[model samples]
Target: MQRITSFFRFCRGRAKLKRRAAAMGFMNHHHQTAISSGQEGIKTVGVDNHNLCDFSSNSDLCICIVTWNMNGKVSYEDLAELVGSSRKFDLLVVGLQEVPRDNILRLLQAALEETHIVLGKAIMQSLQLYVFGPKNSDLLVKVELQVDKHSVGGFGGLIRRKKGAVAIRINYKGFRMVFITCHLSAHASKVEERNCQCKHISHSLFSKNWNPYAKPAHITVWLGDLNYRIQGIDTHPARNLIQKDLHGTLTSNDQLLQEAERGHIFNGYCEGTLTFKPTYKYNVGSSKYDTSYKVRVPAWTDRILFKIEDAKKINATLRFYESMDDIYSSDHKPVKAHLCLKLNKLLSA
Candidate 1:
């Protein structure tokens, strides 16, 4: 009887493994699925074919992107401020890292339900990205794209969702736009690993196979906890500068900026000025720096950046870039940026 029970257990485990493999294989199918707020509840709606909606020659889209690392903790605080509830943005792109649970999605949907609806979501274990648009807005051509590097230099099996990227592509009135959210390798020492992951994600997500026409996105917005730290600065001095509000001085040593300047990562991407302070290594539920034994040096790990395909056809203006300090639900403060995406049809012609 004992031998029979053991054999049955082994067979059950094999069945579970087969089921997981099937689910992973199904992830390759990209579907345009959206959740909208209705009188009954949240409902998933399948997007129909494209060319259903159109815009004027000179169209403008007000976009707001927010990123945060939750540190695997659940925040009971209201996320209205984090979602920029006061402003009426046409599109809201949210990226979160270290999200052990997805309860925050309900909180976010509740916060924006009155004005916006969830267009799509790409989730890979702990990394999640959600895109929201106005509830009454017109339908546009859109595609959901997600790519995960399950094996990053042999670390993928160990780390899993701690590092990966998800993207959503949208073609609005013939202009293409892509929004990507990623969580790169952590720690200041893993700068090269982060750069390599960034390059891989940027190239892999928008490849020919993902799009039907094999055309690239016109405007790409990348946001997330990139894990790049400030070099040549000790923790003590970095904290001193933070207290003195000398963010400009500290940015000179920013790893991401240095890498971009050297054309290593995000070669064509443009980021708003670093007027806000570092957004990471904060004490949970407080404004103080890390108080643990590691005493991680504060860094601007959460960021929002963008790239434009053609300057003549599209114009991007940064309206506001800031960090939410009052809400300290996690070890990292949420960073938010607002931008105006304007397209001129005359220039393209």
Candidate 2:
């Protein structure tokens, strides 16, 4: 009888413990939820302020916008007008793949009011030797080149060249950020090469390698005319030709997306948004090619990507303007992301 009573007591004790554990779990969950709600509310308030007004008061906040392959063909007057129309962007980091010289860049700087230029290795070398010549090349000498400083890793028999990537660091409102503009090898045979380039960029941004210029505290943005698309299937004539045997491995977007999924990076346009229109068409005299044909253009070659932490602060309904009337600027449409920096929390923290 005593044994049975003891067994009953043990069972009752077990039941009580279970109930207490469950209650504790519920309380903990509730506490976490409340804390998360409070943090979100605070963040929302900060974002609201950033969006509603200029960030002049919060000098610690910096806004960056990038447009790639803005070859010299795009006039400064038109570029200025386009930038002027943007609502709340402060710093513009343009990755001009085929910029001819400093003349056009200087004109753009003058027109944009508060702007600077950072030339890529290819552009710098080409312009130094061709445009400015040896005598007047001291100004372009200060533009740092990352490709020369970093080594790319990949399979055997792959081509590795620094000609593909260019970067510029922006100092704004007491905060600093790096903008890397890259144009990878476009050949279908260069899948391994593109992969190597992606790995190089990933390591450069995340690795603990020491460089006075390349520090981790500053946010990094890898944006430009990537040339490769992340789409599962090819729809454009140019892409169809490239997709025959490579099986989409040649695309930097594919590699970047994979890394992003692993919580390494983030893409701003992953939510069914288009960054570039079919800005390229042969001038066939009388009538331009049907603009509707652009719908069939496969892959988003031009894109913007930021670090994961930066993405967490982004509001869901960020605007990407694609329907502007200025068609003569370049062969690619300029992509913009309206990011609101949470200055109050950052400052408080």
Candidate 3:
């Protein structure tokens, strides 16, 4: 019995050694794969060098943006050029309001090396939107990539029955990050409901129990067409109305104001600009509408907001790239943030 027990133990030790050896061999194989295929084999489980998070030490910054109500005329080719022309952000998040079909989304996915998409709520035939991101070249190389979804409460009213929101998560360069795309209620009366929805989203994120803003790990970026504007205490009437409605809520009017004041949430286009551009407008050129001479008006309804931790990493001169000149893409202009994540330095001790 003693001899038999000794023999079993020896066998078990040998088996463990064999397993370790096999794992090492697999890793070596993947390294060679990465070298030969570039980004194609970077998604393998044991591979560590090719992920976006593992970007070159010199590549410290990432750029992102959000646009809403891009009318149906914007094409994937146009969007790619816009992104390429911009600061080459590591990730791009766009909240597309009124994306009539998946054509543009599909085109973007193809144009970008590695892309992900999350479809937002569709209101009427013309009011569909989506969030897109994590433009890494290696994401498509691996067969193990998985995409998941999280839904948030949207503008609930007669005109828009279900204003939905969705989140997308991806693993890049050894870190995982989350991006949320939201389109809140547009109706002036649903301010309270929209506040509740935002609270729910906050709760859900906390429930995940993951601090995306922390160092050496994942980062969370909450961006989209928040449908809220950040301005002075004596600013636009629309801003005042929103403040009045949420004066005594649990979230607090001060907290909301502080978010904008402290730079926790930034308005990409409002910092230096004096005028408000309305993202939603009547398309005069469309054959469906009359071609009579009428004044074209714009509103600053569509906007991009981000958390303080993420905002701190950006350059001070960030602004919206308004030179695409494609009026047909959507009524809303896309806003971008040029950020360089200094990986060489640590955010914490």
Against the hidden reference, what TM-scores do the models get?
0.76, 0.53, 0.51
- Tens-place lDDT digits, model 3, residues 1-349: 4653464355446546544766677433433444455332101011122333333453543545555555446666666764564334555655455455456655665665444443222223324333344434554443222223334433333333234355555544443445555666553323334444554555453245466774522344545455553332322443334335431222122323333433223322122221223333335233121123632222344544433233344222233323223444444555544333453244332
Model 1 has an lDDT value of 0.70
Give every collision pair in model 2. none
Model 2 C-alpha lDDT per residue in residues 281-304, reported as the tens digit of each score? 222221132246554333445566
CA lDDT, candidate 1, residue 129: 80
Instruction: Give the total clashing residue pairs for model 2.
Output: 0
Candidate 1, residues 1-349, lDDT tens digits: the string is: 4653464355446446544765788421111121121121111122221422122232377777888887776544537778864755677888887775657778888888788878778777777888887787665335344433222321234224466677777655455778888887777866656766776676667464555756667788889988899888899888898899886798888888876655557756778777788988888879999999998788989888888888677877676678888878788898987776677767551
Clashes of 3: 16
TM-score of 3: 0.51
Q: After superposition, how far is residue 325 of candidate 1 from its true place, in Å?
A: 0.8
- Candidate 3: which stretches are off by over 4 Å? 1-59, 71-87, 113-162, 174-176, 205-218, 229-278, 282-298, 308-325, 347-349
Ranking by TM-score: 1, 2, 3
- lDDT values of the candidates? 0.70, 0.42, 0.42
Name the Cα RMSD for model 2.
Answer: 17.4
